[model samples]
Target: MTKPTEIKALVFDVFGTVVDWRSGVAREAAAFLQRHAPHLDAFEFADIWRREYSPAMEEIRSGRRPYVRLDVLHRENLVKVLKRSGITGATDAEIDELNLAWHRLDPWPDSVPALNRLKRRFIIAPLSNGNIRLMVDMAKRAGLPWDAILGAEVVRAYKPSPQVYSETVDILGLAPAELCLVAAHNGDLAAARRLGLSTAFVVRPTEHGPDQKTDLNAQQAWDFVVDDLNELASQLDASID
Candidate 1:
């Protein structure tokens, strides 16, 4: 395990790590669909809509398209998914409301208490691919107490780019070793580790639901592996004491 000696701040991945995005988005989409398009299969629609995320991101990453925020990507994908599912009559205004669904996701049950504990010892913030406005709005709506919000929009690059991770440290006025990237996704940790940042893997095994195909566990020897955010806080507190 890497020593936490210089670590002064902890950055977290918001979706599926700190927050239950899948379930939260699913619930909201379902409610909206039932209210508006009663004939549509909300559950199937939600799942299909989320399934489009990776491909959409890939398009941007490959330079086949211009870079767009996750919120815009989600909205574009949602339109296609809704149309494919035979649900019609969605106005542009309604689509805009649905796009904001990502902004209102609920944090995991343990997130608040755990973050509060960590906040007492270190500067805690979100280091996510989400844009600044999205992260700020989500934090506000979900009651996530973050000292600051860092996102790809600030650096104009996404995670796995050393620039983004390094820039975050620079902005925080901390050394690379002085910040830990806490995330449920191993790919995210891998990126941070390669860039000399401390890493913590908090397992969110059910994050993708029963059909989970990736990130079952920490794939590398991360600095720490814990059951949840609460456990992560306990370990950090113990280290300090």
Candidate 2:
């Protein structure tokens, strides 16, 4: 393990790492569906919307499409989810409102407090695939104490992409060894580790749902592996108060 003293910044994977996108989206989706399509299942709707996330980003990754912010991909995916649910009469305003559900995601119980503690010790920010506005809205709503937001939109690429990791380290003006990537997903950590960044795997067993089978444990010997952010803070010796 790299000594904690060597890491000057801690960049995070936002969605599913710090926030509970599933429940938050479902909460908003339920209200929207009740008004627009009374027969749809809100949780199912949220799952459907999220299911489109990777393939949409892969289009840009493969050079089949130009890079666009995550909001655009989300809205396009929302349209598909709605259509799949047999909802053909929803107004544009309604769709847009439902789309903002991503911005309103609730943080996991430990996220805010742990982040504030961690912030006292190191620069903390999000290196997510989400756009700047999305991260801002989420941070404000969730009370996350991020020092800055840097990710796919900033780097014009998504996670697991080498540039996303390398460039974010560059933008922070730190060598890869000086920054740590904290995430729930193994692949995200693997990508960061490949680029010489330290990796922390924060377990989020229900990020997918109760039946989730992946990323339940560290798949590799990450620099740190803990159950949640607070534990990570404790390991890093960040004070609770």
Candidate 3:
């Protein structure tokens, strides 16, 4: 295990780890549905849209499709979501507006405070699958104190893909052992650990909603495991502000 003192930077998974994508997307979907498809379930719509995330990225990861920003994929998925819901009359403008929901996600209550604290001691940034614009928009709206954003767009690949982890560490000019991947998903940690990076699991049991069965706890003996980013900051001895 890499010593905690040797970990100079902390990179995070953004969607479910730093922000509550589920609730925020659902809220936006609810408002859009209220105007266009009031009969549909907003949460269900949000879930369906999120379900498409992995498969879409797999296209790029598997080299079946060239890399594109997440925004494009979200718009494409939004069209499918609307059609699946039997609402095909949405204008291109409305579809574009609705797709911005990913940018409007709200952070968990402890996110801002905890990230601010963590930033005091180490270089902190997002190693998310989200594209630059998406991450920038989210950070600005949510007061996330990312020193920089590094992820799929930078590497032209997605998480669990070795390059996404290795390239990011390369971009940071750090030895793999000098950086820690902080994420709520155990699979993400597993990916980083395999690449010789330190790993920290910050559990978010509600990320997939109340009935969420997966990723409810750390799946491995990660270097650090905590209930939330706040606990993670405490574990790292990053004092609260």
Candidate 4:
């Protein structure tokens, strides 16, 4: 077993970890589909769109495509999904506006206060796959108190890619062990752990959906396992005051 690093900064994974993307995207997609293609199941449409998120980026990760911002990937995927839903009448402007749903996501209930508490003790930033613009927009709207926005665009690579996490530590001038990757997903933490960064798994059972089968709980003996960000703040000894 590897000894965990003396944690100082907390680099967060934003999608399901920080903000509630599933609900947010589902809400927006429902509205869009209701207005345009009422026959389609908007909620399921939202789910299917999110399902395409990874494979779209996986192409870039696998060197099958060049690196592009997440917005571009999302737009491409959105169009494909819309086509499948028989909503091909959507204008380019409408498509672009719809894609911005990712930017308008809401934070989980515990995210703001917990992050504020954690911010008292550690340097907190979003180490997300979303680009800087997307993160900045979400942070401003969701009131996420991040000391910095660090992630894929900053490193030009995605998570589990190593370079993403390595560049983040390098940018902070902190050793791998000093930075703890706090996240809801096991894969994200597993990648950080393999790189010698301390890990915290916060369970987000509804991140996928109510009936979600995966990531219902922590999949590893991580440094800290908690129900939400507030518990994480408490576990890390960050005072609410």
Candidate 5:
């Protein structure tokens, strides 16, 4: 562990880490289908949308495309998945509203309180790949209490890209060692480690729903491996109710 004195800030990965995107999107997708495609499975729709996530980011990662906001990619992904679902009669306006589901996700049970506890002791913010608007909206909706919103949009790069990690530390006016990257994804942590940042791995075994074979457990002996945000706070000597 990088002793508590070493880390002055904690940056998080959102989506499955801080917010329960699968369940949140499922809830919205279910209502969407009930009114449109009564036969389509809603949770499956959410999973399919999520399945497109990494690959969509890869397009930018590979320079096959320019840096597009995640909001745009999500909307494009929704259109493609809807066609596969075989549900029709949805207007563009309805599509736009549903596309905002990412902005309305609910936080994991301990996210808000744990963040509040951690915030008292360190600068806390999200280092998500989501655009600024997406993270801002989600924080307001999920009550995440982030000190700042940063990541892909700010740096015009996504996670695992050394740019995002390096630039985020720069933006916070902190050295790489002064900020801890707290995430459920080992790959995200690994990337941060390369930049000399501290790392905390919090297990979200069901982050990918059942059968999530990867990131179900820590791959390396990271600086901190706790059960969840609450425990992470406690481990850092932050008071958590």
Candidate 6:
């Protein structure tokens, strides 16, 4: 193992990393469809909606469009997806309600307990691209014990950008080395590492479900690569004390 650094807090990526957004969102969408459009194939529709996520974000990242919240992106794509799948007659109120499904995503089986352990030792918070409202709602819904919530919405920038990470550390009144970025995504860890923050990779192989194709394992030598957050907590506790 690499020599541990003076880490005092661990900020995490929420969607797909801490929570099983793909499966949970798909399940919720399916239930909504079954109740509203019984003849529609909810599973297929869910997959279609998810497939649009990256491209939608890319448009903003590439400067082809202005930045929009994930909720807006999800709703825009949902409308097209529902229409393409021949589902009709849904009212605006119903569509608005459906857009909130992301907020109710379920955490991975080990997430809550692992987070609980980690929280006992260090300041634990979510540093995700999700807006504050979305993060707060999700935390409440999933029983996530976050000490504070930080996100792109608060800083008006997203991950892989040094500003968001730096801002988070500054706000927490900690130096870069005093903070660790715990995420399942290598790209996110790489960004944090570049900005002098310690990194921990917690693998979530099935984050994209059975058809998952990326982030199967840690791609770089992070400060720590533990099996899960619980193990991560143990490792950190042993290292610092």
- Top model by lDDT, which number? 2
**By the lDDT metric, which is better: model 1 or model 6?**
1
What does each candidate score in C-alpha RMSD? 1.7, 1.8, 1.8, 2.1, 1.9, 2.0
What TM value does model 1 have? 0.93
Reference-based lDDT, residue 162, model 3 = 98
TM-scores vs. true structure, each candidate:
0.93, 0.97, 0.97, 0.95, 0.96, 0.91
For residues 19-123, could you state the per-residue lDDT of candidate 3 as single tens digits?
999999999888889988898888889999999999999998899999998999989988887888789778898889999999999999999999998898989
Tell me the spans in candidate 1 whose CA falls farther than 4 Å from its real position.
Answer: 35-41
TM-score: model 3 vs. ground truth: 0.97
After superposition, the stretches of candidate 6 with alpha carbons farther than 4 Å from their true spots are 1-5, 35-41
Q: Let me know the TM-score candidate 2 reaches against the reference structure.
A: 0.97
- List runs of model 2 lying over 4 Å from the truth: 238-241
At residue 16, candidate 5 shows an lDDT of: 81
lDDT score, candidate 5, position 130: 95
Clashing pairs in 1: none
Which residue pairs clash in candidate 5?
none
Q: Which runs in model 4 stand beyond 4 Å of their true positions?
A: 1-5, 238-241
Q: Can you write out model 5's per-residue Cα lDDT over 1-241, one digit (the tens) per residue?
A: 5766788999999988899999889988888899998887888889999999999999999899999999999999999998988878999999999999999999989999999999999999999989999999998877889988989999998778899999988899998998999999999999999999999999998877887887888998898998999999898884222
Candidate 6 positional error at 74, Å: 1.8
Give the residue spans of candidate 5 off by over 4 A: 238-241
Off by over 4 Å in 3: 238-241
lDDT of each: 0.85, 0.92, 0.91, 0.88, 0.90, 0.84
**Higher-ranked by lDDT: 2 or 4:** 2
- After TM-score superposition, the amount by which residue 228's alpha carbon in candidate 1 deviates from its true location, in angstroms, is 0.6
Give lDDT for model 3.
Answer: 0.91
Error of 2 at 149 (Å): 1.0
Candidate 5 weakest ten by summed lDDT: 232-241
